[model samples]
Target: MLSRREIESYESQGYLHIPAVFTGRDICEMERDHEFMTRHWASSGQGWTGPWRKEYMDAATEKQSQLVAMHDLHFYAASWMQAVTHPRLVEAMGDLLGPNVELHHSTMHTKPPETGHPFPMHQDWAFYQHQDGRYVDVLVHLDDTRHENGEIRFLAGSHAQGALEHITCTPEGPCTPHLPTANYHLKETIPVPARRGDVVCFNIFTVHGSYVNRTSQPRRLVRLGYRDPENPQLGGQSHGRPGLMVRGHRPNPGGLHPAYSSEVGALDAFKAVPEPALVG
Candidate 1:
């Protein structure tokens, strides 16, 4: 659980960092999974260009494609799912969002050197629907994330207000069509530096994005979206599109994961709505 001070920091700053959430072995296994998947995609004659090809491109080099479709739909089963669902990480989320929460979706952003591009500024909630209370996103960095590596940049206290309308800029930088409700708050952008094992958590409404990787190495990270159980579902579209909802754990069942321990059970706060449920 996060300390009161830590929680306050998150509230005021819109994001917080937790260090060493994984072990060296865990990182090794995840990297192996990434390498295996990239090689598999390359060998398949996919040519690393298309709808899902972005996943293969190295973020630091921008030489590889971005957003490759390597793993099956249920990202929770991907190589890094174990680390993504770590107990400490879960408990901290439960602390902020309450004991009951559901894993909404998972997407990986693997930026390569030189060619890595910036993620446009946008509100995650603008894409997700939640009838419950608050929504949270946990970003797990597989590699050391730094400013040079195109780490995340966020505006503090942006969540206290609602979503801001966004428009495309001439060069493709994120531009708000108008000022956010938070208003002229000095547009502060801070880079969240994380170690190999650290995870960064933030509210959904927070305005955040990342820059192109200037370094020669890859910057890899997984973004998992979670929501409170009782929150009302907003009538809209699915954020992860196509993959849809997998079965949810009842009362947040923990044994669903083979690696789950007594201290950690399933997130009790949510019921997974099926993909068709959105239209239903």
Candidate 2:
């Protein structure tokens, strides 16, 4: 699904954006699924557990709006499972992570108008450190994202240098690695503004973050993570939830944790269906 130039760009620059890989129909289904999940969560009246969930829920409730984001939706929603396992995405992941790639996890980020939160600059590797930096994240845009609406900004070629020391601000908030704002050689960051159905793939160590949404419209997107089966978690620390093998066979017996078949049963339909031609 990726050309030599595109692959090289990802390798050399730490990221690549592919426009219109998904069709309009796909985005519509995703938007619908997101709405259904938001309503279900709200109606259930479940208390938020983790820091991220708590912050998201609190902000949404205060604003009388939808949840800002949710993680591991693929485990519950069939639409999300299909989107995460889409052939084009899986194929593109294979280009980076080799044939035997596993789904690390997936998250749907809904930045509602005006009150959307800002993510401080950080590398994903800080959260999930691997022996080899082989993990890649694909961000699928469901809405047209611009600088005014919290488009992601990435530091070019930062992935090749490896992980940096991170600082913890609050016990309840996210711990992000700090970079000197001044004298940092890679001062000029690239802003990624994408349209609906576009996707951006970035390395795990890539320095990236987004600002608050200033627009009235919501900025929506789904992030899917892929990694090689051979890359085991260091010290048995959990990154997110258990992952499913979306492409190729897993050669390592103890690589991935075992989970209930029902958790990923939704992906069966995608595997059975014939692959579609690449969309431009």
Candidate 3:
């Protein structure tokens, strides 16, 4: 559970960094799983099916075997499923989202060496809109993340202002939605450097992005999202895959698709779940 000051900090700053949420043993297991998945994807030549799939494929083709990112990893690997539904994560999320928290989605972001990509400043809420903006993202660091290795930077207190307008740009040809560059200059930003096993939790409305990795080591993080069951989607956008109820009982199970409710944990067997359209 979070202390009063920690909770207050999150409410005011829109983010918090909790160190060593996972033990050394846990991180080791996660790293093994991560390595296996990366190798599998690279060898199979199965590019990501998400919005950035094209960019990922292009990079992999050019680089010969670089794995950029993976979406809905919980559906593919048991280790990832265990990590997302980890009891500690659920407890922390319960503090913010109340008792009935549901899994929104999970993603794995990999920044490889010097050529890792940078994400433009934007709000996750823009992609996954929910009523009252009752969504939070928990980023679990699988590797040491620092400014030199593409650590995410956040604009403090930006969530209080609610959602901001995002514009589409094709700076390199493949169009992507992001907040205008001018908005990035409007607030004071801070780089969130984290160690492996640390967890960084932030509000969905928080404006954040990262820079290219300059170091030779890979920086990887697994992001899991949770939301109050009461806050349904306003835009009717499906996660592409169904969401799992990880904590407490859902009073209105009907709101969730049957596919999501049927599973308890380790959803590797459910091959029918659709691939997420965007990273979100």
Clash counts for the predictions, in order: 37, 0, 0
Model 3 scores a C-alpha lDDT of: 0.73
| Runs in model 2 lying further than 4 Å from the true structure | 42-67, 169-187, 235-242, 253-280
Task: Quote each prediction's TM-score.
Answer: 0.68, 0.76, 0.79
Better of 1 and 2 by lDDT: 2
Writing each residue's lDDT as its tens digit, candidate 2 over 37-147 gives 766742321212233333323566434433366677777678788888888888999988888889988876777777565555667777677777788988989888888
* Model 1 agreement with the true structure over 140-160: per-residue lDDT tens digits: 777888777778878877787
Best candidate, TM-score-wise?
Answer: 3
- The alpha-carbon lDDT assigned to residue 60 of candidate 1 equals 38
lDDT of 3 at 112: 72
True-vs-predicted CA distance for residue 250, candidate 2, Å = 1.0
TM-score, ranked from best to worst: 3, 2, 1
The per-residue C-alpha lDDT of model 1 at residue 266 equals: 41
Model 3 per-residue lDDT tens digits across residues 1-280:
8888988899999999988888767778888888887777523223222234333235643354343676677777787788888888888888888888889787777867765666667788876777775789889898888777778789999899897877643545534467766547422579999988999999989998877666788778878888987776665234433478899966744333333443434433233445422332
